[model samples]
Target: MTYCKVCSLSGEHPGIVLDEQQVCNVCRLDSVGDLLVNYRYTQEVFEKFQRAGRTEGAPYDCLFMYSGGKDSTYMLDKFVTEYGKRVLAWTFDVPFESEHAAENIRLAKERIAATFVVDADDDGIKKMMREVFNRPAPRKPGNYLDEKLPCVSCRTFFVIRAILHAYRHRIPYIALCADPQQILTMESDVRRIVRGFYEAFGVALADDLFRGELEQLLFAHDDELPQIVFPFIAMRHEYDPDLIVAELKAKGLYASSPMETHCTLFPLLNYYSFTHWDCMFYKLNASSHARAVKRNGADGARSTFSLKFPRSLNVLEVEERLRTVTLRIAKGEGAAEEHEAALIDAFRELGTSEEAGRFIARSFLEMPAVAADMGIRLT
Candidate 1:
């Protein structure tokens, strides 16, 4: 039950090897001034993007992946009003989208002036998810779930689409509205990760856009790579998650915190990652927030959601920290209880493959076993 005083990471996991100082590896590995270096580099990239407007008759300067979340909503406005980039905003609606998130999408479409597009490619989404979810759980959870198998597989699918969309439209930029935690991750590894994704999938997926066409985009030389944009990183934008959520709500651009704002299946997904993988994916991002807090005093704007330590680890306890952030969500951003229904019920409604559904059901059953092994009790 040891916790890093700086970042609040548990020592149960391998990556969280806490030293005698009670500081986790996350804080220990953070090189001084890396954030500043990243800030300067991304700023320079943004400047080049500003100067490299529209690839010589290109329809738009950037193809922004707008999830109708706070970050994308704010960035959509920033690109149009401030950056003055002709944006083609794209929303890929997954079946498990939160009720509030959908409403936010509707509101944003009205307020944000951009060439908006929605792709509820249920067939595509489910097909890839089935492939990802149906895979056998590893015998031993490696590196404490840091690999984030499910999240990575799903994201690579969308990233493949983004690259394909930008290439087809001749757009030079694809903007990913990642939070600072995500922005802080190894940005350089993205190409390798995407390339490995394709390699792992092996033969073609037998789906549109996911076939072999993605290879050209990802496999291209560094100079030939389509411009990828991380808006928060590029601008070194001040991050205040609570403030962002409040502003969006005031503008009628949001539903509420947690449940309706983020993906409905978020809690379910994290549960699976924890039981089967021995770690939660969101912990990676939360660690980034922990690093920020350690370096910068708990500035009001920088204060994260309450990510305090637990007496021990279990589903409910770890899930709380996971909720502090999601994909594109920062650590300690929103309220909890994002979904009320049993996670199994929600998965049944949207989940496609029977085998994948069964895996999830079994995973939930094993949660107690996982906690028991660690001498922790599930509530």
Candidate 2:
């Protein structure tokens, strides 16, 4: 009668054994270790970028994906001023981005006198995001690492768009600001990039109904995009966030507004991810955020949906935000509370009330275990 809590396997299934609590062996193994491996590959990637003549002998070395955030600001400064690379800065101007982020973009351009390009079509972006959020792909296996929500899909759209832009302009490389610790890969080879994309998407998504919607909305007319290069991936984890923020501010690159974000859904998505997947995204992000604040030497501002933000965001806050946004889009303003209640009721109707309750308790207990498994030390 014992059952596995993870994949829901029972004693009737093969390789099942009952533990003291009558849970199956599969669920018991969850406590053995963290599933995803941690790695530092940035330095290796950076060295490759240097050897490949990323900055020397090219008309324009690369296209930088600038988000006008503290990290990207420092990245742009490093690429152009420090590395002596000819660069074109690009921003995907999603409508949900705070006004402050937009101002930061303007400030970065002014400060660097760098050439900039912006792609600002809100309707298309919103539609694509909605489709991604609504689709249900096969749940990721426990050992396989992924973002807890579809927000990763949103990031992918931006990345693909940037690559397509680089391809159209004949740029050989597109630079991104992903830290090595974040991605766990030192791959800078174009073949690796293409293969990774295909592997992540091709088979699992081939017959997915959402694939059609994604293609229609985001990739109807596909163009060969330039190879993505992560120059920072090769640098050692020596760039402290606080130091970078301070340096940028000294260069007159200050936060344009308090509590603004380049990606509107980042906080909310992180919150949901932590809740459902036992992923400590914000904690991971907090390390970088702390660096930014220290470098800026200013009072740290909270992310839009962070508990440390102006208003403490608890589970209720998460529910309220999601309910409000979804209802505003579906029914218009002033229906948020009603919508929130309705969604909660629907969960109950689906008999997820106890499931949700258990998930919350398990997530809290499992987080430390998962973190330990991943070799991520929580201070």
Candidate 3:
């Protein structure tokens, strides 16, 4: 009854055994080692930034996505002061971004002479996100499973918006503070970058909502923005998280309280993903609190994972935020009841009912999940 650790398929299930690990024949032949090689290649690509002198550019070499987080702040400072590239700091003001994050955005603009743009269509964005989260996710059979969350959908929109901004503004490159470890080996190809959106939302979703803008944006062959580069990849060669955080803090750029994130839907999205998917999507992310602590010398032992829905957020606050988001989405989409009920049911399923609400409130403070119910497709 032994099962493969990688795929969790049965040992008796006719697969080639490799190194006594009993991987399925398909998986064995798939050459997982190739992924490591690809990662190395991706790492090399990032290292090239270090060799290329930053002074070779104008006031700014790229547009940096500034989330007001430690990584982005540090990277922004490094690019401006250390590398000497004039950067255009861009922030997407989604509905749920914390007030502190907004302040940090102001601080970043004042601290750096970088031009700033904040896209604040809170109502529209929230509506789009509610639909995105509620829609049925297409099943990707036999592949690594993805937990669908409003956050993923929200970030996809941000990237698209950023790309559109870059294309229109003629910004040569768009810089993301995404760490190498955070990106998958498969995502090295730029083509696959938007595949998740296509896969999850489909063409209809784009056509119906984005007015074919997303499709046109994705298909346009020319004038694409600069490759998304992770300066941290190169920094990894010289700096660990501790050094990076310290340097940023010394510069008066630090992670803001209540952790206003660049992405608004991260907390709720991560909460759902962790509970339902058995995947710590945020934890896997290098910028996640756990990884931040592990990499940046922050207190790793402390649960900085902020989406502790009920516990981290006061009951009143939770009710208020949910009510606000629900109303916004409802007004936009005319489907407030459906979305609200879904949220309530999801929370209840996670034992957020009054009786167990307090106990389960901080459950997401650590990753939490339900026992295996039959696999159900979540759109």
304 Cα displacement, candidate 1 (Å) = 7.1
Tens digit of per-residue lDDT, candidate 1, span 1-379? 6677776667765445778999876677644377667667666766787787456868888889888777788778878887788999988777656555677778888887899887666667666665655566656424534446656566666776777777777787778877654544435333664666656566566335365675575566665456777767664457666577677778777664432354544444564565564456456545545556558646621423222212122333444444333311222222323421233343343322344334443444443443344332222
If ranked by lDDT, best first, what sequence of candidates would result?
1, 3, 2
TM-score, one value per model: 0.71, 0.55, 0.60
Name the lDDT value of residue 332 in candidate 1: 28
lDDT of 2 by residue, 192-243 (tens): 4434444555634422413333332234233233556655444534645456
Cα error, residue 268 of model 1, in Å, equals 2.3
lDDT of each: 0.59, 0.50, 0.51
Query: By lDDT, is 2 or 3 better?
Result: 3
- Candidate 1 has a TM-score of 0.71
Kindly give the stretch of ten consecutive residues in candidate 2 with the minimal lDDT sum.
Answer: 304-313
* Model 1, C-alpha of 364: deviation from truth (Å): 11
The runs of at least 3 residues in candidate 2 whose Cα sits more than 4 Å from the true structure, single-residue gaps closed, are 1-45, 51-58, 121-124, 136-147, 185-227, 256-259, 267-379
- How many clashing residue pairs, candidate 3? 9
Error of 3 at 63 (Å): 1.3
lDDT of 3: 0.51
lDDT of 1: 0.59
